[model samples]
Target chain A: MIDVLYFAWVRERIGLPRERIETGAATVAELVEELRGREERYQAAFADLTSLRVALDQELASFDAPLAGVREVAFFPPMTGG
Target chain B: MRIAVQAEPFDLGAEVSAFTAGVRGAGAVVSFTGLVRDEGGSLSGMEIEHYPGMTGKAISGIAAEAVARWNLVDALVIHRYGKLAPGEAIMMVATAALHRGDAFAAAEYLMDYLKSRAPFWKKELSAGGEAWVAAKDSDEDALKRW
Candidate 1:
């Protein structure tokens, strides 16, 4: 089980803040594809990957990266680090 | 190296003191606190939203990068979320170093990066209704100078 979290516009679009996702996906991209198929809200929220950023277990990571043993995945916008 | 994101208000003096209490040989401690500003009734308040785990890591990464780029002994940042009233504290950044120059420069740099790169979004609450504030291009330009 992987904890997936969303923030800001992503949450607004998905109508959810966080969820525990059980998946057989191998990578973040695959996980995203799974989400995109869940509902229209997810599809709209993730429609443009170019506008989103992914973090695997609180570390910045690319979508193509493997999710082996990953515990958390968070989707957000390009971080404006403070 | 302290990072916090909270909805409750923070005491500036206490936070700064806590950050510098154990540090020795620090000649200068520079701090910046962001507050809610009244935009002539254009805004009634501000709603700060952030990614939970990602928010901390983002701030930490920026702090780490700033420390690596500048000669600073330590950095501290605290950003608040949820609803905030006018004149309330929004965020703070503190840098301590052996000299004034590094402390000041790094503090400013960290703030600039924070406003533009962090995964936090703020909405301006006004009589006109809440509107998500877009990322300012000026902030992006400011980061380019570094």
Candidate 2:
């Protein structure tokens, strides 16, 4: 089981901050595809992968990154921090 | 190096003073504070959301990079999340070095990385409604200089 977290507008669109998911997807992109098939809200939140950023186990990662032993994954829009 | 991620407001003057006093041999100290600007008076406040488990680690990693690259004597980063009012302090970065150039450059480097690399997201609340602030391309461009 891996914890999937969402932030900012992604959280607003998905209506949750985090969730536990059991999946066999090998990559982040595959996991996103699985999520998109689950619900329309997930589809909308992830409609454009270009506008979203992904993190694996609290570190920034690419969609092609493997999910091997990762315990946490976060999806969010580009950061606007300062 | 000192990194603080908290919801409570911090006093910029006190923070700067304390950081300045802590650096023993540094001849120059540079500090930058970011404030919430209510452009056109439309913005009422800001709501900052961040990844709780990653915020501190990300900030410290950036700070560590700045310290190594600039050979800084010391560095401090303090960022606040949650609701913040217009004109209130949102965050600050302070750096101490042997010369002004290193201090200034390191502070700017820290700011640039923090703007695009940090996990914090800001939502501006106005009379019309609330919306997440999109990351500016200029901010990402700024990172290329370093």
Candidate 3:
């Protein structure tokens, strides 16, 4: 199972901070597509890909990156830390 | 190197003094603090959210890179999350080196990376409304220089 995490507005929109799910998706993009199909909230939270960033196993990664052997994935907007 | 991600406010004076005292053969120590700005006098507070599992790891990665690249004697990073009042410190960075140049450069590098690369976000609560602070294009551009 991959633990999917969300933060900031994404978490607010998704209505939960995180969840664990089993999936057969091969890439992050495919995983996102699976999430987007789950409900309208997921669709809305992911409506704009450009406004979102993804991390695989807690590290920034591209959408096309493989999800094999990854245990965690996070989605959030661009960070405003300092 | 030291990295702290917590909800507790840090004492900048004490942190700097302790960091400086702990460094070996360091001639220069530089520190930078970032405060919660009440822009337009509307911001009452801010909520900083960060990934629990990634924050320390990401910061350690940045600090490690800064230490390696600048040959720094020591480095420190402290970031606070949860509700914060205006004028309160949001974060701080300190670096130690044999000379002022490396210390200063490393401090700047830590700030630059911490701004965009770290897994933290800020939401400002103002009199008018609450909004997430947008990531400036300039912030992303700033990373290219390093």
Mind sharing the TM-score for model 1? 0.84
Provide DockQ values for all models, in the order shown.
0.45, 0.95, 0.94
- In the order shown, the chain A TM-scores of the predictions are 0.95, 0.99, 0.98
Question: Of the candidates shown, which would achieve the greatest TM-score relative to the real structure?
Answer: 2
Interface RMSD of each: 2.4, 0.4, 0.5
TM-score of chain B of each: 0.95, 0.99, 0.98
Error of 1 at A17 (Å): 1.1
Best by DockQ: 2
Candidate 1: segments with Cα more than 4 A from true spot? A80-82, B13-23
What does DockQ come to for candidate 2?
0.95
Q: If chain B of candidate 2 is superposed on the true chain B, what is its TM-score?
A: 0.99
Tell how far residue B136 is off in model 3, in angstroms: 0.7
lDDT scores in order: 0.85, 0.97, 0.95
**Tens-digit lDDT track of model 2 for B1-146:** 99999999999999999999999999999999999999979999999999999999999999999999999999999999999999999999999999999999999999999999999999999999998999988998999999
TM-score of 3: 0.98
